[model samples]
Target: MKCLIKECDSYDKNQQWDIVCDNLWKLPLSQSVLMIGVLLGNLFFGSFSDRYGRKALFNFAPIICFTSSFLTSFAPNIYVFTILTAITAACIVGMSQASFIIGRIEFIGNKYRVLCVNLQEIVYSLGTVIPGIGSMADIQRTDQ
Candidate 1:
């Protein structure tokens, strides 16, 4: 079992992984994996969607995203968690933002397309920010 944190005191039962930060060194690595995945997804999926149609990627990526996300929660170790996180991040970008926005734009009238995209951006921004706010709030962790 690979462990990301050398000094973490808490263990997650589902993922069988460590929790809480004793040092910040490994945190950036985790974030970097997600960003790299997103970059790869954007680069690859953009061309893929263009060639195969956005609808197919839009329809398929979410199923992959959801499955990877579900599996991430139950990952047996840090390595699996990292791999799954990358997959989840890739799928989120490929399915939610790129394919979805393009697909929605194609179906809307010219005059309404900008408005539709702006609305989608607003919703997506809120969805991203709200959870971050919740996470930032103080919450005590308990041991069983």
Candidate 2:
């Protein structure tokens, strides 16, 4: 959302009415598609990971994610970028979550399983914080 907001602001400042309108109209649709993709990918991959093994999936997902993200960064237009972004979100982020949860559960003893699950919440919070810190840097840079 922050990135979209930044792009919109850039277009608005430049008086690029067509680009601005296109971006504004498409934001909701793009978000909806991404949400659906995430949900569906999660459901499909979660079961597949259970049947197969975590190590292979875990290692492979990051490669797909990184490649998709790298390609997205260089996308020629918004449509291509959005499609790549959705693919990254679905294959990379969605699959990673499923694999991580399954792998985390399998590794720990039954007694410590609950604690481990709770610990993941803390780790995820930390993950959010790292990006929040980067976003603050982005804010500062934009202010300049």
Candidate 3:
């Protein structure tokens, strides 16, 4: 993203909009926005799940995440991209934690809860790392 931004002088493809210029502060701002969205999702959905049930939120969140993520891909400018990304991030957090994790723990035996949670986290970590590894491999291939 940093490379692309520099290559384009922060302009969108076809030069329709300016993303940022003179500095790259918006990158951090976008990340902070995503974190804020995650925090809000954790707070709201955690309680909402307790009240409404995990299935409702779990079913709903993915739809929102997919829609927002799809919209984000077509964002006309940085602000729009940031907003949609935040929404996507929040939905993902709500779906992954408020619904799935809680529901998984609740259905399992108490003695196994900790182990199950740890395993879940390990799987999630691997899911994250796999993409990074794929990107690294792509970079290496390009370098070669």
Candidate 4:
């Protein structure tokens, strides 16, 4: 979200409407599609993980996310970047949450599941907070 917002702000300031439109126009559509896809993917993966296993999908998801994010960062054009971002959204972010939940359930016992999940949420929030603090420090430095 921060990255997207920063990109949009930069484009706005530079008056790069063509690039911005090309990159952002399909984002809403992609987000909606990914939301639906994530729902279906979660249901499918949740069932599959229960029957088969979670390790395979859990390990593979991070690789897909890293690769897609790296590719998107280096994309030559707005169209390619947008497509890569959409693919990342669908394949990486969409599947990763479900995979993580399944993996956690498989590894941990039932009694601790809720606590473990909540802890995970707390950790994620802390991760975001760290970056926010860093950004705030940067702002303070610039104001000096």
Residue-level error in angstroms, candidate 4, position 113 = 5.4
Q: What are the per-residue Cα lDDT tens digits for candidate 1 across 47-132?
A: 77888877788787888889999999787776687889999998888775565655688778899998988998899899999999
Clashes of each: 0, 0, 0, 0
Instruction: Determine which window of 10 residues in candidate 3 has minimal summed lDDT.
Output: 11-20
Compose the digit string of candidate 3's lDDT tens values, residues 1-144.
Answer: 442443544644433544345445777888899899999888887887888888888787888999999998899777888889999988888877865666677788999998998998899999999998887784633554
Residue pairs with colliding backbones in model 2 are none
Candidate 1, run of 10 with poorest lDDT:
14-23
Question: Model 2: per-residue lDDT, tens digit, 15-46?
Answer: 33234544576666667767776776687666
TM-score of each: 0.60, 0.61, 0.67, 0.45
* Clashing residue pairs, backbone N/CA/C < 3 A, model 3: none
Q: How accurate locally is residue 99 in candidate 3, as Cα lDDT from 0 to 100?
A: 52
lDDT of each: 0.77, 0.70, 0.79, 0.63
Model 1 Cα shift for residue 22 (angstroms)? 7.3
lDDT of 4 by residue, 72-98 (tens): 777765556656665566555446666
Q: Could you tell me the lDDT of residue 107 within candidate 2?
A: 80
CA RMSD (A), model 1: 8.2
lDDT of 4: 0.63
Best by lDDT: 3
Q: Is candidate 1 or 3 superior in TM-score?
A: 3
Off by over 4 Å in 3: 1-16, 118-144
* Positional deviation of residue 106's Cα in model 1 after best superposition, in angstroms: 1.3
Best TM-score among the predictions, by candidate number: 3
